[model samples]
Target: MFRPAASIAGLITPSPYTQFARAAYCHGTNTWSCEEACAANSDFRVYVTGGDDSDTPDFFVGYWPTGNAAIVAHEGTDPLQLLSLNSAIQAHTGFLGAHSRSAGVVLSAVQKVISEHNVTEVITVGHSLGMLHTIAGC
Candidate 1:
C-alpha cells in the first residue's frame, strides 16, 4: 500500500520536507493508505515507506511533519506552536503526563512497518520539530 512519498506528499502542500523525505526515502505512502492494513489508525499521520529490496538492509522510513494536525484529542498539542523546540521535545518525551497522542501513532506506524516488513533498519526523516521526533524515536 506504500505510495512513494512523492504521490501522497501533496496531502500537505508546500511542505519542502515532503520533497526531501520523498527523495531520501524514495518510497512512502499517506496515512490513509497504510491505516487499516498497516495498523496506523491515528487521527494524525505518520507516513510509512518500505517496499524496495534492492538496498542492502531493507528498512522502512517513518515520516512526521511539523505543525500539521487534524485531531486535538491530545492535550497541549497546539498546531500553531509545534514549531517551538520545547513543544517538539515535550511531545516526544510525553511531558503532559501523556504524549500528544500523535506521537504514539507515529511511533506505532514506525514499529508496525519494521515488524511487518522485517526491516533491519529504520530511517526517520523530517524537518524542524520533526527532526526532534525522529531522533527521540531512535
Candidate 2:
C-alpha cells in the first residue's frame, strides 16, 4: 500500500501539521490519553482533553493556531471501551445509548473550544471507526 513519494509528487499531500494531527487521531483509536500525542505536535496546542473508556467515547480538542481553527480529534475504536467490549453490538445508524451520549459530549466540547478560541472553523480528524462519525456529520 505504500506509494513511492516520487510517484505521488504530483498529488497534493497533507501538510506537516496535518500529518501531526493524524498521529493524534490514530492514538485516540487505541488510547484516551491525548497528552503525549497532542503535546508532541508543535503545530497544535492542547486546550482541553477528556474522555472515559468505560462509557464515554474519547475526544481531543485543541487549538490549531497556525491553521486558525480548532481541531477535534476522535477515535474509531478502543478495545478498552466498554461498548467496544460488548459482543452483542451491531453496526447501525442508531448507535447505542452510551455512544449517543458520548457523541453529544464530543460535539459540545468542540463547540466550547472553538467559541473560546474564536477560531474561524473546525478541522475534524479521526482514525479507524472514528471516520464513521466524521462522515455521518456527527
Candidate 3:
C-alpha cells in the first residue's frame, strides 16, 4: 500500500525516463546498475527504487538515451543527483523491509546533488506504489 502527497504534482512531469531501466549481468545475476547508466549517459542519467509495495520507483531525473530528454522524478529523494547510493536508500520511507528508508534518504541526497550540480530542471516518475513514493518526496 502506498499513498502519494499532492506536492508531487509540482515536482516533475511524466516522461519516457519513467520506464528506463539500466541493468547488467554479472556473476550469473541481473543487476540494475545506476553507475553504469550514469557513466553511459551522464547528462540524462538517474536512479530508481522500489515503492511501498512490489512496484519499484522508476526515475528521479534525466531520461535514458532512448527516451526523451526530460527529467522524470523531481522529488527530494532523487537518485540521479546523489553521490552515495547507500545514503539515498536510507532516506526513503513508506515501505517495508530494506527499502523503507530509501525515499527519505534519496530525497535528501538528491537535494544536495541539485545544489552541488546546479540542476535547475528535473522530472519525477513512478508506477503503482512507486508513484506514491515519488509524490511524497516532492
**Which candidate comes out best when scored by TM-score?**
2
lDDT of each: 0.37, 0.57, 0.40
By lDDT, the best candidate is 2
lDDT of 3 at 137: 48
| Off by more than 4 A, model 1 | 1-99
Residues 3-122, model 1: lDDT tens digits: 354656566553333443333322234333432322332233444433222211112344323323211111112356446656435332333222243455656665665555555544
Local error of candidate 1 at residue 53 (angstroms): 34
In candidate 3, what are the lDDT values of residues 1-138, reduced to their tens digit?
A: 222444766246422333232221111111334554334444454443323322333334333334333334422234454477464465334344323456565666456556655665444444444456555545
Give the number of colliding residue pairs in candidate 1: 0
Please provide, for model 2 over 1-138, each residue's C-alpha lDDT reduced to its tens digit, 9 standing for 90 to 100: 133355564356654334544554344423334454544555666655555644544556666777777777655565454455567877564345445755665677668777888887777766656555544554
Pairs in clash, predicted candidate 1: none
Give the TM-score (vs. native) of candidate 2.
0.58
Model 1 gets an lDDT of 0.37
Q: Which regions of candidate 2 deviate over 4 angstroms? A: 1-36, 78-89
